[model samples]
Target: MRKKTTIEILLFSLIICMVLSAVEGSVPILPLDQVKAGMKGKGRSVFQGNRIEEFDVEIIGVLKNVEPKKSIILARLKGGILEEAGVISGMSGSPVYVDGKLIGAVAYSLGTFVKEPIAGITPIGEMMSISEKRKKGPVFSPQVPVKKHLTLDELFMLNKDFFLSKAVFHSEGRALKPLSIPLVFSGFSSYAFEQSRSFFSNLGFNP
Candidate 1:
């Protein structure tokens, strides 16, 4: 949800208050792990949109609406504390672990206004899918493969470089084909990408 809206900010404040108030005298739970669907857990969050401190909450459900988007988690206030800390802004990516297992991350914040403490969460598996991709940067081959042994203008998808996992290496290579004789035009030319063909035509080039 867009964070610029005023209503969204207010909704976050309410949830933060709910969680913080519910956990009174109770330790605020914020553990880290891989979150999955249907995992029950809790979190502590502070809502900055309004005056509120860390609050606690219980997760109900995990949802996936679109790929690459944060997961949605369904939850409600436990009916204890102030009822503000249940869910709040800046709580996205909050870790949800159940039975010592990570189930997901916090995703829901105030988008459209609501009455009670309610929010969605992102699954920990999806979060891992993202975190796992961060490491060692992109893999680059030191040496170019021999010509005739490679294909022209081929595309390759970069694989994840896991830091904690054991190293796994594959002996694979790619071929780079020439897009022009001077090679200078290729540097800034449309052929640099798939849409270049159309871009060049827009530049008055015939096919």
Candidate 2:
């Protein structure tokens, strides 16, 4: 009887450990409907020196249907490095939590020259949905030559669809081309820059 009791206790302990492990791995997300305006939260991001720090988040309100069925969380941030430098460009994907629940990530910047840092939070649900789709789909595979010898007209013809899709037209009818990615070159020759510009430009990238 003692041996059977010992076995039962061991099984119970094992079951408890398994339950705790599952809980730890799963991050409980707060539903968007539950989030209210004027609620306070904390955001985590790496500011400088590779250390992730916390900042204060004051909820303004949720922007519903901003992007065709997708919504965003609008919040005013205070404290941390925001006091000195406003919103850092590389701070995107910084996870935000409200009431100890995961809310979203710091995705959009309101303005550059503004004194206060106001940002748009891409909801955690949206991000998770994106991740799920990516996991289930085949990865993107691009084919490109080592040296692109295509002319400007040829390049334009080949990538016209991409440029058209990315092109943003303002109210004044001015075409605002979106930069695919930002590249920085330090101490590189002007000739090198000019030569590489075609390659990058053909690949729908901004150099």
Candidate 3:
């Protein structure tokens, strides 16, 4: 009886390990070092409401050292509404996969009024590193006291580091900024809405 129970325990542990391994194998990561120019992939995002859609992606090349110890994968996206919309807002953080291996997320695009669907991908490794750091501790700990009511100027001063930090990349004389997301407001008077819109616009939001 003892031997039978021990065998059952070992079998259960083995099954759990096998299940975990299979799950991990399903989504394999394509390291940045292996990515190259002209490689093709597919990106997934929600172009419309709730439903996820896929678009074709072709690697333009890699921009090495775009930031300190960081890199960005330059790719041209096609298909779906990408041709008509040209990398729509809120499409950032969309996953791109190459050869069934996860590569990166769509994060940056050329400024408004451009035609092509060119985008910059933030690599999976760097994203994972940031995620791990987040699990360890808070990424941003403000020095300001949270219990106190603050004016708009005081609030801005307290979080100025976060608000002022914008990562801009240049390509062919065009600046690449994070995709602009539309801001919708409700339950506000016209004057209040206008003031709020102007405030967000100054902070680089589409309002």
Top candidate (lDDT)? 3
lDDT (C-alpha, whole model) for all candidates = 0.37, 0.60, 0.69
Q: For residues 91-166, what per-residue lDDT tens digits would candidate 1 score against the true structure?
A: 5444544565545445544333333456555454444544434423343232432223332212111221111111
User: Model 3, 23-78: lDDT tens per residue?
Assistant: 23457899999999999999999888999999999999888887786788899999
Candidate 3: what lDDT? 0.69
Query: Against the true structure, whose TM-score is highest?
Result: 3
Model 1: lDDT equals 0.37
Candidates 2 and 3, the one with greater TM-score: 3
| lDDT of residue 141 for candidate 1 | 38
- Which window of 10 residues has the lowest lDDT sum in candidate 1? 174-183
Per-residue lDDT tens digits of candidate 2, residues 1-207? 334333323433353344224223367788778778999999988777789899999998887765454677778888887877766666665778998898877766565455567777767777665555544654322233112343444434443432213323221232222223344656757965775576455544457
Query: What is the overall TM-score of model 3 with all chains considered together?
Result: 0.68
Question: Which residue pairs overlap in candidate 3's backbone?
Answer: none
The runs of at least 3 residues in candidate 1 whose Cα sits more than 4 Å from the true structure, single-residue gaps closed, are 1-39, 47-56, 68-71, 79-86, 136-207
RMSD of each: 19.1, 16.5, 14.1
